[model samples]
Target chain A: MPQGQPLTVPNDGLTTKARRNAPLLAVHTGPGKGKSTAAFGMALRAWNQGFDIAVFQFVKSAKWKVGEESAFRELGKLHDEHGVGGPVQWHKMGSGWSWTRKQGSEVDHAETARDGWAEISRRIAEERHDFYVLDEFTYPLKWGWISVHEVVEVLGNRGGNQHVVITGRDAPQELIEAADLVTEMTKVKHPMDAGRKGQRGIEW
Target chain B: MPQGQPLTVPNDGLTTKARRNAPLLAVHTGPGKGKSTAAFGMALRAWNQGFDIAVFQFVKSAKWKVGEESAFRELGKLHDEHGVGGPVQWHKMGSGWSWTRKQGSEVDHAETARDGWAEISRRIAEERHDFYVLDEFTYPLKWGWISVHEVVEVLGNRGGNQHVVITGRDAPQELIEAADLVTEMTKVKHPMDAGRKGQRGIEW
Candidate 1:
């Protein structure tokens, strides 16, 4: 037998129908990039294959942004066409960086963060869908909204048959280490940093 | 003003925005139903109006099941056509299901449930998507995989500006009570119970 290859046994205890468990895959990439985009593509691919799927968008509010929200709406349309039923759920943080700037330090971003994490914890324990995607997850840890240890504990103990993908910049080293698969996206070049504003339908 | 209507006094020391937070909606329907489908439609409507959106799919495996996976795979294509970027993301649960027939015990189911919830909790805490959906969340709880209290904690504490949705039959009483909106799908009729299996391009 080749090195590192499993040795076949004619009468081993294992049956021909026995199946092996699948490991988790995590996608972590840098800022101003397509980490979430790539993750979403993978999700659509999995969903079309008849697997049950669930999605949680952390830290974001419903306020209209230019690019991200519009594309999500399109995904929702696709979900509808496919007749996969579930509420496209959201847990929004009341505070935003811009809003906080205008309102001063009185804004309570911490409460928003706390509230968001609580819901997240519950969903993980419940294990409703076969696949989950965590978008922009790194920020909570980066912003000190939640602890890395807590995140690790939860992920380490997750159920079998569940696949997860996480996207963000500045992912914690612990998270990267815990993940079975990690992909980093480097921004080679972009039109935004050159001082040209984002264009509608292209950037937004 | 009507009895239930608020009595205003020159703004009452509060801004109009403060008086009403954005509407947060959640929909959890019955088994083998279309909760995600309805939520997705709402997301599309919100997106077309120029809202910023985000998406996360929970408990998904890499194995393709139907056409939905293909649609998620084409998320980048959708983004390219719509000129939206950054908001759409996806995550998959790398682990597959915990089989009851194989394990042959409730304890195995319970363990799987616990693991599943842990993953869901981790993702919910980390990401920041505007429209969040927990598909088939009630399954583990129903099957005795996890406790209901844990599920409640997450749902109750999520941030504002997120319209959250959850789907499944026999949702806990607390979830319904806490929700701003709730819809229970009573199956008046279903094709599967009538001896017809799910039809592709329609059932999925």
Candidate 2:
């Protein structure tokens, strides 16, 4: 905390009494790995706090299974069995969505991405979950499939204590400006640079 | 991956045939949030691979309980009950370390930090764990408590398939150059900029 300049408080001074608890719009975008993973970590924390958590992975192939997906799914089941926490729901582009159909073309992919965004807009309107993680969501926006302006507007006006996190590289300027918390994962070096392939469990 | 120049492969190409599967030295350092959180997520991935996981938290107060601590502890316990995964050990500066004796002075704090480094050096040499997460480790190095040269040397020579992750802001240049993977968390926005304080689950 003391290494660099201490973060500036918005007002001259912000005491606990003056602290307002508001929903956060967090964006994790960068070339370095783990942008989605960090968002998942936040989701895990939110779930521990009993927040209803929803995950929408925009790009990961249905065949790919991330460790977080299974962990959260198990936690979701625990909610039903033990009634210890809130509900957990996860939807991936491949399985839960058929917007692009089984055989996908560029147009179909774009169409599916838009449908996905529309559904997210609805969820935001309904305040369906306390925490929403849009994994690899930046692609659709960056690809021009979903309008960045529209996404920003919906997120900016979302109601209640809904915390939304979007992850992927090259986040739009509008979305970055709109977010309350944005972290860009800048890559310094990687094993991949050493002509190495990502390992199972480590990379996926 | 395609937005910027695609990352350069160390050589012509790295296929599974030539994949070394060597241990990784990864550093996560920056002003933005989630450096350590991303490391924790990587730890979670390693744990799923059944690698024995050890977390050494350098700066977080003993009283400040991060959600990952509880989650990993439970996962460790499950290793004994159901034999599901690897053992997990977490050591924070406050309790496990007494180099500063409880009451901390500038000089005393520096001594404690160095002691922490010494212990980590031993662990690296001993190959104590498959995965090592040095949370907020860059602080001691940045503060000049530990010799960066010694650290780089020890880590460079560590044996076995031991992976190490270091997280903190303002990491030394030498460390970045030494690491196999280095990520700098760049800040784009924050809740504090809007006069909002961190929330319980989100911040921790």
Best by DockQ: 2
Q: Mind giving the per-residue lDDT tens digits that candidate 1 earns over A1-204?
A: 001122342343444322223425465455433455545544544455544555555545543232334444455565676554222322234353322232214547665555556666666788756667776778878888888789878877877566677767788888877775555544423322222222232222
Model 1 lDDT per residue over B1-204, tens place: 011123333424644444344335354454423344434434443444444444333333333223443453355345556554324433333343332233313335456556656765665565455555565566666766677777677756666455455656677776666665555433323333322323232333
Fraction of the native A-B contacts that model 2 recovers:
0.54
Instruction: Give the per-residue lDDT digits (tens) of candidate 2, residues B1-204.
Output: 322123554555655544646678899888988887788788777777778998888874664446777767766765666676578998777644643355444346676677788888888889889999998889889888889999999999999889899998899999999998888888877777665766756775
For each prediction, how big is the interface RMSD? 18.3, 3.7
Off by more than 4 A, model 1: A1-25, A60-91, A94-107, B1-69, B72-204
Candidate 2 clashes between residue pairs 3 or more apart in a chain or in different chains: A195-B10
Q: Candidate 1: give the TM-score of chain A.
A: 0.71
What CAPRI grade goes to candidate 1? incorrect
What is the Å distance of residue A190 in model 1 from its true position? 1.3
Fnat of each prediction? 0.07, 0.54
The residue ranges of model 2 lying beyond 4 angstroms of the native Cα positions read: A1-19, A63-65, A83-86, A95-107, B1-20, B63-65, B98-107
* Chain B alone vs. reference chain B, TM-score for every model: 0.65, 0.86
In model 2, state the lDDT of residue A181: 89
